[model samples]
Target chain A: MTEASDTLVEEVQARFDDLTILEYEFDNVEIELARKANALNAPLYKRRAEVIAKIPHFWALVFGRAPPEVETYIQPSDEKAFALYLDTFEVIHFEIDDPKGSPRSFSLKFGFKENEYFKDKVLEKKFWFRKTSDWEGLVSEPVKIHWKKGQDMTFGLTDAAYALAQAKKRLPPGNTDKSKERALPEYKALADKIEESEESSASFFALFGFVSSWRYVSAEESGKIRQTEAENLAKVKRGELVEEPDSDEDNENDEDDDHDYQETEVFPGGDEVAILIAEDMWPSAIKYYKRNHDDDDSDDDDMDDVSVNDRANENDDDSDEELDIRALVNKGRKEPTSNSPPMPPPARKKQRKA
Target chain B: MTEASDTLVEEVQARFDDLTILEYEFDNVEIELARKANALNAPLYKRRAEVIAKIPHFWALVFGRAPPEVETYIQPSDEKAFALYLDTFEVIHFEIDDPKGSPRSFSLKFGFKENEYFKDKVLEKKFWFRKTSDWEGLVSEPVKIHWKKGQDMTFGLTDAAYALAQAKKRLPPGNTDKSKERALPEYKALADKIEESEESSASFFALFGFVSSWRYVSAEESGKIRQTEAENLAKVKRGELVEEPDSDEDNENDEDDDHDYQETEVFPGGDEVAILIAEDMWPSAIKYYKRNHDDDDSDDDDMDDVSVNDRANENDDDSDEELDIRALVNKGRKEPTSNSPPMPPPARKKQRKA
Candidate 1:
């Protein structure tokens, strides 16, 4: 390239870089917008939770009418667990205002009455807004659900994941390298078991065991790393430290492929499912509850499709539809809809219409 | 249903209705959020436009690298017009603070140097946020371009649309009914010509002739209708006027089908195209301009795909890539990229990779 052309190229690049800084400013404004929205929404959500608590089977029916993204992950066995014990569902945007964290970080909490299914009164799973060298988004660690004998709705996926987590916890602190984690006996056992298991239908209960394909980093740890990186960048600019271009190569070696995750093991599409529940299902719980009534008042076609796996859609207006009997003794429905042997609700009904 | 069950249903419905009010409140908060963000962004965008104005062929390269939603509309002929004299483009959200209007309403202004395509130095199209009885969205009227002899890029579509608009303007006041409008000679002529024409590709220039699938009502007219509706509803509640169940039926009769819009005449996906330009193209023009440079700096694969219809992708860094020769006589690029005959830039290149 000629000197004049090179000079022109540099001028263009300078303007482009300036615009990138502006884009960063735009992103900061977006983050502030999210914080404001979250603050305004918190009180509204609290009031909604209070109102929904009075309606029996509110969470159960809400799950039934959830948008397909969430519905697709639910299996028949999970529906049975939900019908028996599910009381209320709540989503918390726990890091909306944290400068070091992200607005996308949230926790999904499920309240359940003591039932034959599990011992826990509340199960909470948290997804953290995290960043790796090349990627940035939500990442979650597996949650352990202590299931009763023969009541493990996820088969053995959750158990395996939990056991692996315990074993990893015992590893030397800095040995949390993914290749070393994969080399653990517990991790191998889980991987082999996942391979041996048939390609069976997934249960929503399996979602509790989801681990993001991206390496999981706690928000606190990520914040520390970011602080150090910024400090080092400043130092390098001041000639106090040499810039290390090879650092990226080190991160690349610990790539996600080290996990060797199977589709079922990692819970495919889990992030989308979590987001849909947090943003749509939780906020629109009343609409979903009303849908249960709409389905009853509208047609027998909607009512007839409730089977074991589809227990979420059962004309639960009767026994199953009632809020957990022990939890809401006086809130049961007076009359369940007409009798219909339940089958699975029609899959992708809207897509079929299109 | 038993009376007890009926009472239960009513209770449920009451709670559901309360939740709907909350949903409406949520929507209001969203509107306020948009207002706040737009205020913050206004100055940032103004500064950006100033920086970009100094760059040569900024608008042309930005349009070339625009997302597929906008790119799909541009044809070879339209690209030639853009290459020749498309000087600068601006998007203004003209109704951001209008109490009765919407933030979605905007005007796209194109400042062009003297060119063969048209006589106007500046062409502007405004899309208004409108509401009909059944629909609410952005709608626009066709713009007339005084084409220089033999330079009409839309192949008569714009002429037909503009002529129809003129004819409609002459209709008796309060006789703007669609059925009557379609009865006009110009309307039928366009419809018949549309029917007889073979399936032909479209030009982006033709988008200036877009009409919404929903009936077009001016923002002022819509505001008046809303005010009158509110007054009527209040009068009915006070028993000053009897409620009319047939009002909706009257609206249904004036439904969109009365216009009998063919897919091409109304311009399929015009609303989407308008929104993409306003929200994406205008804001991200710098990223797009950088992409043109990236294509040149990278490899032969990206630079070799500029054809007549694809003139936007031509390595114009030499001649066409420079700012319109007359507008910025001294602002020409020093070196154009390596030469190869340009084909239409690869269609949906990203999708092809997938």
Candidate 2:
């Protein structure tokens, strides 16, 4: 073995003697730990119970077999139940709410057998808590689930589940109806009015072209940069969309007017072309422009254009971050019909859907 | 107290009994006990030891002082310690590959202390494992971590640290070809198509418009309809595009003009006006279209024309779904150099800056 391998083995031998994975006496202890730590701003996300309590129809997936532990609060008759069982485990980890005074989060995750005939079926439960729990309830509702044998969905949910648990346990209000409405543009427009708007940078054109993809630029996605036209310009001036454009169109042929993202017979007017061109290459185009477009100090251009857009997205994620079960327990759902968009970071979850 | 109160009290009293949690023994056996009854297919996850190895920083955040556990890999002298710490957590939680046969996920989640000293600290660690470990190596690299709390960063890695204890991980292949250029539009001429092409279900246009908050509609958006546009007639004559117009514009518009969404704003010039307008009312608009417009027959023709735009950016809360770990891990980085657009349901994460 190489020297590194030898050293690694030695280190491994040493650690085996020192480290031990601690399991809490009960999942509730994790909640207690989180409450103590979150007062100082710690990360405490432990799935208090292994599953989501409300899954309208869990047994249907498994056909006639429902795991034993899956008690019927309301089991649909068509679905199958393997058995009734309440297997429990101690959760030791916690998600930090603040991150400062809190130590580290550790919780116990346990699985309850839900159905055997459906194969190795069980209701998975994770117990998580955070410092925010001190003010309200301690543990989050059980997030119950059913998955195929060897097809656990936790990979997508583990971090996301806890992130949300902790955030909900920690952060305050941000997502609102007004905010949701402006999330797309009004509240998020990068707010960079180029003062010299005289000569646009190559990046500006690049970004504009990129956004065109969303608009549907079909003719030349490969290598051609279609030239912008006059009628399209007037429409743009009037705030009308034209067509989706390709980036590689040669500028030399601008006067020839035959070459444009919408130049072909596809569109009847210039407005439709711009829309296609605009949406396709935006994010990258925006990045490039933000990197190079600020030469002539524009109006209120202090904030990076990309940053503004990013901030909006980040703020949106924040809602994902603050979905604390502690808070949920403290406050009853106000608007039953409307659900808040989760502010994530704290809310990033492992989803099987993706 | 009422019976409900008595039950609550009994539950609380039982909880106070300090029952052991996860490690609860069944017949004095150390192995996990099967709940009293039944079975169904449900998976469980456990974090690899290596993930726990780098959590010193997480511990530090809660305690206001990192545990000796973290010191070996991240020293006070290393400014990258915080970054490294978060990176470790992010890497382990979000990137661990989903191998075939191993579907459940394991991640460590912990609790925070409720004090001021360790503000923003990490209290506990929850280890989550996913079902895809079998496929990790095919898509991603093995994580390299310094195991010994006292190990020197400048020194080489130890074998123990690189053991199979590491979770196999994968990076979603978001095709990125930087050398490729964006397509720019022939902005000026795209306007004509706005006036001539087909139009979509008015509701789709309205919803898209509302969501994007397109204060006003431009002809470009209005240029094409799902059915047929006059320009397509010309295109068919020229054999430019494949499908011919289903019917002439005047003929189709005769019966469908009423299909415009309730919220669209016609552009100044009749030339270009946006038609697909589903926004804040997306769910409703689609529902309405599905039930009223199509019912069964006419729906097929207009379905393609419904332009439902993702007007509002959905920030994933990591709500156990639609997660992007790379973004979550490198959240501290000013910007992550990612190339793919965020996906629906679960998001594709931003990549490391090369």
Candidate 3:
């Protein structure tokens, strides 16, 4: 064996010993452990065992599965990390982590070098989250990882770590407040305009599409907002709540405040709030233009052209970095907020059927 | 109003009356109904009510919402069906069904024209299944329909009909005997070959991927098969059950019979069985080839070339049609046979990490 291969074996061996001790300690404390103990151990044991098993599997595949003269090197970086170099073109990194104080909780990261095997053959990165109740010793359903273009090589690894951390409520340092406040009057006015508009059902839906594509609001959330606004309007008609209709001066003041806030507040990852504000104002702008041209039916064509041009300019200003913000917003929406099963990722705009 | 619009109103009015009768009949039979009455009525009432509400919403969005000069027409085809033609290229079809005997059970189909409004805007076709017990009148989680390329526009409608029919045990006529017999010896041989192979952890996983992609076997089912095979092998080792190892002649006879069976049996919808058989034999074929070439290191390159060529040939023979069969197989595996929450769809192959 090469020196690198020797180091890999030694490193894996050391981690294997640590895992064994952890398992033993877990067994001893089984009775005293909390309910989470089982949850933690379920993934931990499976991951550690998988990592240990992968060492021999990697070697066998590299040597026995491939050509014999295809030179390879394997090395251990630390007790918890190892690397496999497949000639000069490819490398595989394997890392196993069990945060010091967490029992029965572990994560495994397997990194593949971007090579022919990955480019043409490998489709997705998969991580198994073995359920604690799987007594049959079968690996449970896996969590699949899809690599987006321009994603970092360690994207899957970091995501796994983040998922585990979130599960354990130990997520990395970040601002806890992610929620943004909406100006109720502005939302109410938009809802009213939509209700009164002579635009076709198709146009109404098109407006929704523009909003969803430009803002953080999901299709589901947008529906909820519409329903809420509708219900609130009904209540107002029934005199169930006092209405404080804002004057034109108040509305202008609110818009200026919103614009200033959008300019000043930099959302850490993306400007979702700014986009939301922009989309929230979009319908009003159209309504204003329509009211001015209400007497001239022929002018509708000019209105459409203007709006299309404006949208094109907006697209031009929104860089790829900003587009990625939409992905982040989608990810944030997927995080489970309650005991309920996570709502399937917000339906993509491309999948909508009117 | 035009004659078409009058007919549309008349048809909807008739269905609305039938729905009202159904609701009243349901109320009369409430005390005699089983506990499942509530559960059944939950989605039923909400869907019925939404359909009713949508009538006004639809009319308002069509005539009231659109420009007066847009030139629209609406007509009813039957008591339970209607259509709205918005100009030349756009049409919307609405259908409501309450199979005569199934009280408090209904389905609504909303069809959209494949116009500009739909082209770049519509994503998922959504139907809300609201529970009657929900006092807040919040729309429950929506059931989304994704249209596959070349799929019928009314696929969602037909699928919903099928689901309701299945629930009511009123499915359309067809031969019901769908189960196939398993050839245990072949499975045992395959399992034995995998266990004896030196391909390590990777081989074991390849075995799983092969099983998952090929058979109706789930991860859980694969685990059970492995456990059973391991135990049987142990018993054989201990000289318990007579091995009755197949002689060369017996193996040849079995192969001939298997080939004849494959030629005769036809699977409805698609030949999933044939594909399964092909994929099931894939790994074993590779293993056999590898075993034969094991002693000669220089032959490795040749083996790789042969395997790659074989795989390419297989790919050429397997059309997109058969690839879709794999998806269907995975879907079948996800549907729980017993009383359990439906397992999420099988993780797609593109999402696999390793």
Candidate 4:
């Protein structure tokens, strides 16, 4: 490989490796799909296989083993673009052809559109990349990529970048350390507590499935959103901010309003993430009920003070920052907290997330 | 208690016992919820408790033993109605008032509406009853007793009756059979097959969950529906029935049209059933995919002949009647069989049953 090609390969490999970590968290779903392939719809398995094939180092990154013999080649098309081939199948085309003068602007053409599984589903497949220092102000952000002509199909690459950075942060701090070891001490402690509790291992697995399935935001972003909301709630309880007028009446006007706020566009393999969550998250979901029940028992006067302090404490705990399993497991109880802002009613109508 | 009240209690107990059997089929879900109660939403548990409480022999039937010390009193409100009091709380009011003059006509008023958990949610709480000869031509159908003004919310009594009848059919037959034994040899054989197969016990539990959660129709009705569809498909293959013009173009006009065919209303405790299915069914679902795959391998010419013979043999096997778990597990491979009818695409959307 040439010098430029080597650099490109390294960058792609790094990103692919990070995604593999996320994929590991969702291994239960993969196993389930593989086992149940015969019982499930044929088209579903086809779709899943197609997505897995798109990522580089698929087996090594996902299964933590050497991949089968698969040849890959990088051919430079022009000064602004290059094509990436996997086993004679062109997977992606990277292009820096920008009409507007922007900093390090580039676009990725996901070239597997010709694959039978995706041919009819995807019209145009491309993702745009732009640099931004927003993740802890330490890493660059990639813009949401738009694909499919006349469609609002986009996925947050910024979220993916943030997720990867967060995963790296979990490793023990060290320069020039490329060990596969992840999962901090705090995470281990949390898992231990879950195991020690009356909850089954299914709950723990379910929580992992839920985390891996978050598509609109990265695990880091989801955690940040929860933390921010909790902090805001604490502030409101402390009389630092006034509460907005309730929107319950407006929400009642639209029975299907619960779906209105969901991200319309999804990333590749997003549907699979949702399927995993649905299949695995039920046992852990019981935590929300328990928290709500506990909240219901405490006197309203003292409960508010306790909740506010709890929220504040959570914000300060950096070790348990990203994708706080405890918080995610308990977040559903927010509806019952006396001082917490009223959330919209739970969706009465069943919604099937694809 | 008077003789009439004794008879009423016996009747209620019989039906309640049948329901408890159905509940036992979904025991995995109950245990999961109970274990993870501290992690789940409080309202969910409250709702579950309420449903269980609605049945007269809830404690005795579920625990398979005597219940806790609780007072219950029956008082006739009039010749046509009676009130049932449990621990100074009116739980149900049985009324033999039917303006339509239906045979064996009665209504049950679930009197716990005033409880805080149910106050805002249940606008009307009543169930109607009518005589029916459907279950071996021998039972009565329950109707939805319309109590609330401007509301006609009701559930199918026939479906419930059919479900009870089907459960009875699964039990070994003998005169004066009062042994607590359920599950005929065929059921045991199926369960043994599942246990011996590559699938986990969870998958077996999940199949039960799926069967129990089906709304709009009873287990018997669901079986009948599938059988009818299969027969229709067979006729279509035989060129006895004309095919409808392909509606692929119409379906393309609306991508979100899939949900239009789903049943809008769900049975009570439907959500719990769905949770069970997601948590447990993955391993067994593989059988369907495997069957479909095998079917794909066979040539189209003799495949039809093989399928017809398979279907004919299946019809002859009386022991495999009812919801054959093996057939349900292996149904996905229907494509290769010429006599097998085509099914709609699998539901890709994750629908929360409740």
Candidate 5:
């Protein structure tokens, strides 16, 4: 190694420190921008919720036309459930104004009518902005879904995961090692169940039971960790402490990977799925709903432009279009001509004949 | 298709319109945030420029340690030129305050000492925020390089591209059709040159002569296009105009592809490269410079922990580390012990012997 001039090294370090400070300022500006945007969006979102309430199956149609990122996770059974019972949907930036919390923390609330699928009137999943030893982002716990009888859309996967999580919670403090926890009957049952099922067959309802691939930390724990990190950073800045190197931590991470049940097996890319739903699908609900109308107009225009006049040709075109989820959901579903559909589980006429 | 309830459709459209308005507000918030961040960053950047100037070969070392996204574009000769002649670097968000302009518009300004490479003291390449029929982004013209005889790093490629661009500029307004333009002598010469050369071996200096793959529009033209679009949108909102269908536009794009000299043939992903440099590299220069030092300390620590002691073993380790750009740049090169190196092109002792 070459000998670096002491003063030159200090100069470079000083510049690096200044750049770090500038980054801190930029982060503050982003947080401020989020707070301001949220204030302006609140009233408009409230108005939208009221307007969308009067339109029957509005959310259903929106989900039908959802972007592939979200649609890829929805099973055939999930679509049926959505068409039958899904109602008002909302996303709340719950920590936008909390000084100690991040704007990234948000809640996806889904209101549903009394359906045979689940007992909860409102299934709300919250993603808390979290930072751990080597990872940082939004993390969530499995939301319990009370399914009636044999009506579990996710088959028995969600049920098993939820039961295992409960059993783990009951373990005594300081005795919750990974091997010990896995030995529990509930954990063994869930593991065996997961081993037997094909991940591709899992329903979108499995998302309700999705937890982080890494260790799940509560919001309170995340906040405390952040505070401790801040303190440690300040100490280093003041030259009162030296940062510890995690040279052997890689081995521990590898061990964790060996036994960990990655959330992807059940709900592939669950974090990204939840994020897309909250950030895009929820905010642009109306856009997706209106997109179906545009698609229908374009399809008809293409057929006419191509001079498809035969009845048999038209029937073939209809069959091809039926493969699109939007077509299946809106096939013969009549818009509410008189009063809106009842708040309770009104029998939704099956629109998909195919 | 089933008949859509008129009032219900109207209700959905109205909500969509409201959401669009909210999006407009959100866009305004983002612009305001940029303005504020720029105001804060301006002074810090100025301080950085001054501090970096005092450290000789500062930008050179930083470029040597550039992230892979930037490093992949830089040829071996580019590194030699940077080590010998590149002095200071600055990125300017030139359109941050322009009412009709976008903050995305930025300039990559390189300050170079008098060298055998090019005549320019300051090579300023500006990317104007532009919009065309099917694209919106920062677009730039081929910046002419006044290169010394027999010293053209891009091997006459930049010369050919610059000549063709200049010739195209002189074409009559309506006669600038692509097919006819491609038949021009300068264009034919450039086409032949590109056909013969391996893009992988092209010098990074070609970035100076890069143009957008899409039709390049000046900021003035972009502002006019935006104004017209806004007016058309207003008319549509007021029920005074019907939006035209763009069913044939796709076919026109295919036609454009036939004769267009896609910039990727010269510089693959030039747009993304410029964006990442301006947005990531420029703002985080100090971080990259310091990262090399951290890498060195870690490497040494690993050697000690693994009990590497033999002198021949140490020699082998040094040979393996030679491939690292940081090692090549810093190898046995004594830091400025007395005065910083001169501003002009000083003879930098060649550090890469491998």
Candidate 6:
């Protein structure tokens, strides 16, 4: 309505008219997660409402991001089980717990689907933005918000939340204890999925799953450390990980060497002594037991490595969003080089065995 | 025919016509345990090749059964799984180290259908039988087999022995493993109608899929145990578990009147630790926890007085089968009635989490 503002808007639109908005990072993850938490709660009784509330918060701690809004939820009307719609989101937002909080962050997670899962999954997007920075101006720009429909199987506080929500929707909410009678497959499937993801990665974050305290190593440092490993393995073959340096009588040059079977100061933090491991472990000893026995052998080492990396990513994502069941199943699948087992999405979240 | 031969025929039928067939033993339970021994080889491959060999002998160890005339086995194949049927045959003519070699075994196994599943399953039969002392007579009986048309969800196995004479015209001999793999499910469905009779009592034997090493309470013990429980609960509430005996000094009844919680054990097998136990832990807890949550004056009872006998028969019929997928979402499912969590069947036999 103001002449000055209209004039400014016209100028900006004219300049960026040719710019195409292909991707958008919406702080929708929170909304989406809450939506699912709400959906699963539909079948639960009011007294069991705590189950629904506890689920997402617990997952937000584990998964890294809370995306996927429920498209639909099918509950059996019992305390046993039901189904959920799962759509892993691209944009992730973490509430900035600072004094000047008026809507905080929106960060685009950069990772691509291998094939046609999305048109430009791997193509980078400028995700990070602060709501305070001309946030209204950015909204005017054409942007693409990622959306899809899918299904998942999960359990826990979410299951309780889900049951409670349903119960509240149908009846009235007070104190619900129906959570104790939580469904079977949902709870079990959730446990199974978490373990599977970790099985693939064994990241310090994944380790935090069973043991509260955990250790973490930076992703980049992990790679550098491994490069040193190959060097050490070669040297050991030639008699070298430990060598007598010219500087001393001791087997020196140790300071120049990197750590082996590396450890991290940070891990899935639960106050336990759990250690964050590298992604490479998936293709190695953790899954090596099966590959060594397999009649098939090839040069595609990348496939095995995904199992490890995915696990860590899963944990990292937990700190940012809700868990993704399909992605979790994909973590434990046999290396794709060997016909990867059935679409892992059928599996729940991956976790370590207790 | 000589007159003397007529007398001999009578003797032969008396000895061979009737057979003492032993199926399963109710006294013992067979829990299929997954072995985590990396040094050992999985028999899955060998069993796959011998399409008509005997079922694996592991069932005997699982059920703690004496080796009968036959055994049951489970084998996963290249594309599917096959539950094998085998016989403990006695071949009298064979000899090895000694002149009296206990008739060696000669097993025969075959595949059949279990459901409407097609590509979801594959079928083949393998046997592992012991040699017999009455081989000539056993060979005299011919097996008659048939596969009713239309319905494609069942099958059976019968041998040319035990006086089933002149029945070999129904089916053809088995072929190679590859052929069986190709024919499976389809042929299995075709053969679904081959059972001789459906006996209701025998269904229980079939319902609990055979695995090796489970320990179930003996039927006699199970019944008595349930009955004892019913009486105990009633007595507990009345505070009348002990009765006053006449002609006794005041000191005489004190020891016996304290409580029966310290007396005989009630669990399936925790005889040495005769601790007090509720008839069922979970349900009882649910009832008690909910009811007494408001009552603060009930008792200042010790935790030791809390019972651990809850999980006993809650899942007696179900084998307490919990689905274990590869996730960490909801791993530790507590068994309320019992102190210990319910143990799930192994995920993968050789790679079980210990």
For residues B234-322, write the lDDT of model 2, one tens digit per residue: 34334343242233322232233233221222122111111111111111121221221122212232221221111122232112211
Q: Could you tell me how far off, in angstroms, the CA of residue B105 lies in candidate 6 after the best superposition? A: 16
- Among the numbered candidates, top TM-score falls to 5
Question: What are the root-mean-square deviations of the candidates from the true structure over C-alphas?
Answer: 9.5, 36.0, 35.5, 32.2, 9.1, 35.6
Q: Which ten residues in a row have the lowest lDDT in candidate 3 chain B?
A: B132-141
lDDT of each: 0.62, 0.24, 0.25, 0.26, 0.62, 0.22
Cα lDDT of model 3 by residue, B97-134, tens digit: 22112222222223434532123223221111111100
| Prediction 2 TM-score vs. true | 0.14
Cα error, residue A17 of model 5, in Å, equals 4.0
Task: Flag the better candidate by TM-score, 2 or 3.
Answer: 3
Cα lDDT tens digits, model 1, B1-354, are: 366654564455445444545665666776788798788888888878787776656687678677887887777566656755788899988888987777778999999999767898988888987764334677788898888888776668778888887888898865646777778899877666556543777678777887775555665556755565455445533434323335434344343444445433646567778889988888766656655544442334333322112224333443433333232332232554332112122211111100
Kindly give the stretch of ten consecutive residues in candidate 1 chain B with the minimal lDDT sum. Answer: B345-354
Task: Judge candidate 1 against the unseen true structure and give its global Cα lDDT, from 0 to 1.
Answer: 0.62
- Supply the DockQ value of model 6: 0.01
- Chain A of candidate 5 scores what in TM-score? 0.78
Candidate 4 lDDT, A1-354, residue by residue in tens: 246534443343233222222223233333333333223323433443353343222221121111121111111111011111111111121222222221121121123323211123222222222211111111122222232343211122223333444554566553222223223443333334333432321211111112211112233432443354345445533434323223332112222323321121112222333233222221122222123323332333222222211222222222222222223323434442222112111111112111
lDDT (C-alpha) at residue B194 in model 6: 24
Score candidate 6 by lDDT: 0.22
Model 6 lDDT per residue over B172-226, tens place: 5321123332244433332332223232112111111111011111223333333
Query: lDDT per residue, candidate 2, A23-76, as tens digits?
Result: 111222433443543332211112112221221111122211222322121133
